[model samples]
Structures are given as C-alpha cells and as structure tokens.
Target: MALKATVLKARLNISDMDRGYYQEHAFSLAQHPSETPNRIMVRLLAFMLNASETLTFSKGLSDEGEPELAERDLTGDITLWVAFGQPDEKWLRKASAQAKAVRLYTYGGRTVPLWLAQNKAALARLPELEIWEFSEEDLDALTGWFERSMTFQCSITEGVLYLNNDDESLTITPIRIKDRS
Candidate 1:
C-alpha cells in the first residue's frame, strides 16, 4: 500500500509592510512521504510571501507539471506560479509561457550559488521570472517552528521576513537573484 500524505493545519497572521497587505489565513498542507520538514516549511514560507485569496497549493512533489503554489483567476487562468528549489531552464521557460508571472525560491548552502551561476543567463532571458534565494541557516531555522497544528505571525518589512510562534522566531531575508521587470 502507498503511504498517504500527512495533513498539517496552520494559522498564519501576515503583515506585509512592503506590499501594504495584512490578513490571516488558515491552511491545510499535505506533506508528501518523500518530502523533508525543511522543504515543507519553505513551501509555507513561499505561500506567505505571495499570499492571496486566489493562491492555492498545487500537487507539489507529486506533480511535476504544476508549481508548488499557484494563483489563478476565476476563469482558471494561471496568474502567478511559484516554485521552490533549483529548476532547469526548460521548466522556467515553460512556466513563464504559461503564467502571467513566475517566482522561484531556491535554497541550499553552497549548491545554490553554483546553480545560479550555471542558469543565470537563461533565467535572465525569461521576461516573467523572478528568483529568490533563502540562506541555508535561515531555512533550517524556520524548520524548527513546524508542528502538526500551529499558529504563526509572519511580518515582512522592506523585504525582511519574520516568522514568530509563541516560543520562537525566525528571520529571513530572501536574496533576489534575478528580476525580469
């Protein structure tokens, strides 16, 4: 029998000063058997960063054709596509063509720099792409706050992010590697 995805519930109170947005969102995330806690947390973080009523988590890790998170219009057009980790140029090209905007959140210590160097030129050519990298230390720190049922207050100001639970807090500043308008 196949292992089922674990369902985790969370409540996020977000205050994004940079975008002048404030809202509280409840999420039910399904963690795949093969996924690590760190990756799961990163996906949550990505969702927080681009939180919108229309944004929804896709069949991540299980579906290669869909993004980790996507924002769609009422007409079912993909407005925004959000991906995590290192994706190849072909995937970037395909996502850019399909969505109105695409954002990639990459994390991993030394490997990220090398990956960026290799794909920078091709990624730069995509007019609808934006790339952000989270530092390994920060990513690891965020993982510590995960729980099956949890609550968090996420604040973003001037591109700096802070995720706070009652017991602990983690700050992350995602580096913008590429922005094509």
Candidate 2:
C-alpha cells in the first residue's frame, strides 16, 4: 500500500512593510513522504514571504508542470510563481515564459553559489526571474521552529525577516544574487 502524505497546519500573522501587506492566514499543507522537515519549513517560509489573498499552494513535488506556490488573477492567469530550492535552468526558463514574475528561494548553503555560477549566464537571460538564497545556518534555525501545528508572527522590513514563534524570534536575511528587474 502507498503511504499517505502527512497534513500540517499553520497560522501566520504577516506584516510586510515593503509591500504594505498585513494579514493572517490559516491553512493546511500536505507533506509528501519523501519530503523532510527542512523542505516543509522552507515552503512555509516562502509562503510567509509572499503571502497574498489569491496565492495558493500548487501540487509541488508531485507535479513538475506547476510551481510550488502561485498567485493567479481573476482571469486564471498566473501572475507570480514561487519555487523553493535549487531548480534546473531549463525549468526556470519555462517558468519565466509562463509567469509575469518568478521568484526562487534556494537553500542548501554553499551549493547554491556553485549552482548559480554554473547557470548564472543562462539565468540572466530571463528578466522575470529573481533568485534569493538562504544560508544553511538560517535554514536550520527556521527548521527548528517547525511543527505539525504551529503559529508564527512574521514581519518584513527593508530586506530582513523577523519570525516570532511565541517568545523566541529568528532573524533571517536572504541574499538576492540575481534580479533582472
């Protein structure tokens, strides 16, 4: 028999000073059998970074044709595509063609720089793509805050993110290595 995906629920109170977006979202996400707590926490971090009323999680990991999370317009057009981890240049090219804006949150520390060095030239060709990388230390810190049921207070200002889980708060600063626009 096939193993089922585990369901995790999260409540996020987000305050984005840069975007002037503030809201609270309560949602559930399915964690695939092959996924780790690190990846799930990264996905949740991505959600808080780009939280929107219309943004919804897609069949990520399960579907290669869709983004991990996306914001669609009323016309059913994908406006923003969000993805986590290191993605192939070929797939990013496809995503750039499909969406008006594409953002990649790449983790895994030192490997990210090497991966970018290998594909930076080709990636620069896509003006819609933005690549942000998280340090392994910071990712590990964020992962420590993960749980099956959790609540977080997030605030973003300038280029830094502050995530508060009860009494403890973690600070994260994702470096932007590529931004054509």
Candidate 3:
C-alpha cells in the first residue's frame, strides 16, 4: 500500500527593501538586522502574519488626534507587539534582552513564558525551523527543491514547524517513515 501523504503549499514574498539592502537577508526568531523600525516591522509582519500563532502591529496617535509622528517622517522607531503561541512571560524578556534599536514587546492582552517556548512543552510550537540567509548557495539549493517539486513533502509529529522561503513555494506531506523504501 502507498504511504498516506498530506501535502501543504507555502508561499513567501520578501520585502523589496531587503532584496535591495542586505545580504540574502531573512529575519528569524533569534535575530534581526539593524534597520529602520518601519522597515523592520514590515519584515517582521511579513513573516509573523503567516507564521506566528497570534500577533498584532499598530501605532499610537498624537495628542492632536493624528497618528503619532504623522508630521514627522516614517523613519523613526516604532514599537512592535508580538505573542507566540505560549502562555508565559519569558519570551518577551528573552526577545528584549539585547539592546535592539527598535522596541519589541509582549502584549498585555496575553503573554507566553519563554520556558514554554524554549522547553518545547507547548502543544503548538516551532521546531526544526531554520532561517536561511539568501545567498547564491541558498538560491541554488532552493532551485534544486523546485526542480524536484513532485517528490517533496514535510511532516510534523508533534510541533508547529514552518519552513520559510525567500522566493518559492512548498508542498508538505505527513507520512510514516517506515512506509518509505
């Protein structure tokens, strides 16, 4: 009998700034590049909206009832609020440990402790995730993946894993390893 397979396709579109500005630039849970807050937020949102379990992004308005810094250029720092799928407070602490130019904070709405994020105890989690810095080599590898699209598949027995892409699509399939020769 053929192995039962679950196919999933994911699409990724990187920001134009990233394509024009940095080295095969791709953001990850572990780090971000030094750039403007708005651009950074765009980058984060591009990834989070698709990958994060829960998240939000917004800006405060000025006392004049205008959007905060409406008169000013959109080049200033802006705070970002993110909440991964965990019920703890440590993730915020960890993300804030380093002195990044932009502010990254947890939502008062709900918090996910870092231990749960770190310990892999959460039922919904990101594991076996990798952030690939776009490079000629990486592009070559992805080209290979595309050329062999018909044979590709991915599965998760326990956690929520996302395979990010700079410019590509994918099909994920869940199957028993033993069924493969």
**Best candidate per lDDT, number?**
2
* Order of models, best TM-score first: 2, 1, 3
RMSD of each: 1.4, 1.2, 18.5
lDDT of each: 0.88, 0.89, 0.26
In candidate 1, stretches whose alpha carbon ends up further than 4 angstroms from where it belongs are none
lDDT of 3 by residue, 92-169 (tens): 333333212112211111222333246443322222121112223322333444321222122222322123444554
Model 3: lDDT to the true structure: 0.26
Write model 1 residue lDDT over 1-181, tens digit each, in one string: 9999999898999999988889999978899889788888888889889988888997546786887799999999899999888888899899999999999998888999899889877887899999888888998888888788879999999898888999887889989888867
Clashes (backbone N, CA, C under 3 Å), per candidate, total 0, 0, 9
lDDT of 2 by residue, 119-181 (tens): 978998999999888889998998988889989999999978899998699999988888856
Of 1 and 3, the candidate ahead on TM-score is 1
Rank by lDDT (best first): 2, 1, 3
Model 1: lDDT equals 0.88
Top TM-score prediction, candidate number = 2
- What is the overall TM-score of model 3 with all chains considered together? 0.19
Q: Name the candidate, 2 or 3, with the larger TM-score value.
A: 2
Kindly report which residue pairs in candidate 1 clash with one another: none
Q: Considering summed lDDT, which 10 consecutive residues are worst modelled in model 1?
A: 59-68
